[model samples]
Target: MKPKNIGIQMTDKALLFINGVPPENLPDTINYSLIACSDGAFHYLKEKGFPLEKLDFISGDFDSHSGKDETIYHEKFIFTPDQNKTDFEKSLEIIKERGYKEVDVYGGSGGEMDHFLGNLTVAFIFKDDLKITFFDDHSHYFFAPNILVLNDVKNKLISLYPFPKAENITTKGLKWSLIKENLEITNRIGTRNFAQENSVTIEFDTGNLVVFIGN
Candidate 1:
């Protein structure tokens, strides 16, 4: 769904969204500075009893959304006409324009498989510019490039799946560890690995490898 790496001043938090609002997996409490709604997700929030008054921005092309609720936050709406990008992509642009470095996305899962996979691409697009976590109620996914050391991972399950390809990958502090190995899509994957210690480490020389440490 949406996902992490943490440790920042409490004041410097992230933008939280419900999907179309954009995606993330954030802590329960951290001063949420802004809230966003993407495309049709605006209506999803409304149906679920989200306080529409606190909605700060709405981003997307709005082709799939019914405009009946547009009047609620019309002033906050942003339209990106590019058909190539998804609503989440459109929202991230607004997030960057407003100078936010982190975003936590909720929802955007349990729909179509292609759309869900398309949503995952946002992490690759913004991995260098912004730290975005695409999280639903259950799953947490984050991009791990170069090196990743996760703490507080006592007994959770972790998986290393590459975005097409990753090179010279290595790992430590898990039930199984890799040393200067390679992980490729379809050909080979390191999945169902356990975090044996309190901390787990991963290293890669090139490519985007997403580490999924989940319950």
Candidate 2:
């Protein structure tokens, strides 16, 4: 089932595929306002027999997309050769330009560890501007807001990672609940925790908190 979250259910939600490990299952594209992918990811979608006509745009440097592939989808390609920004970031910029505030990303994990870390950094940069959630074979994660509520999470492996640090955290429905506790990367961090109830609530006063819900 599709993960039911306010961020993902928001209007004008976009679906984006990047260059990493492809998702095991492709989500229903009809649920999104727009569907897009990076150049490297397009090959997978094509190989998987995904309907190319449904794709709104394909953004990347197009370093690998050439010859026949380029000719066929030339009109749909948004050539962004900026060496300074990753293709994932460039795609997010395009999504933002199209007035999309929320996006569900696939292929954002696995593969190269450095790329995975870089993707997380990109997500952190756009935390305020975009409601971004990443889905992989293992789990789905997003940068949690001050007041966050998750449903249908009973006994799920839930992790609260401090992007750098978080303060005044209060949580409910977790096996080991935190009451006004602080978390820091260099100090203490919350990881490998489980939900005690079907619904969980997490509240923090400051700092970025990344919530990972095991699938």
Cα lDDT of all candidates, in order?
0.73, 0.92
Measured by TM-score, the strongest candidate is 2
Best by lDDT: 2
Q: Distance (Å) between predicted and true CA of 147, model 2?
A: 0.4
Question: For candidate 1, which ten residues in a row score worst on lDDT?
Answer: 1-10
Clashes of 2: 0
Off by over 4 Å in 1: 1-10, 16-30, 63-68
> What is the C-alpha lDDT profile of model 1 across 31-119, one tens digit per residue?
56667767677766666666676667787776666566666567877877898877778888887777888887776556677776777
- TM-scores for all candidates: the values are 0.83, 0.94
Model 2 lDDT per residue over 126-184, tens place: 98899999999999999999999999999999999999999999999999999999999
User: Candidate 1 at residue 109, lDDT?
Assistant: 59
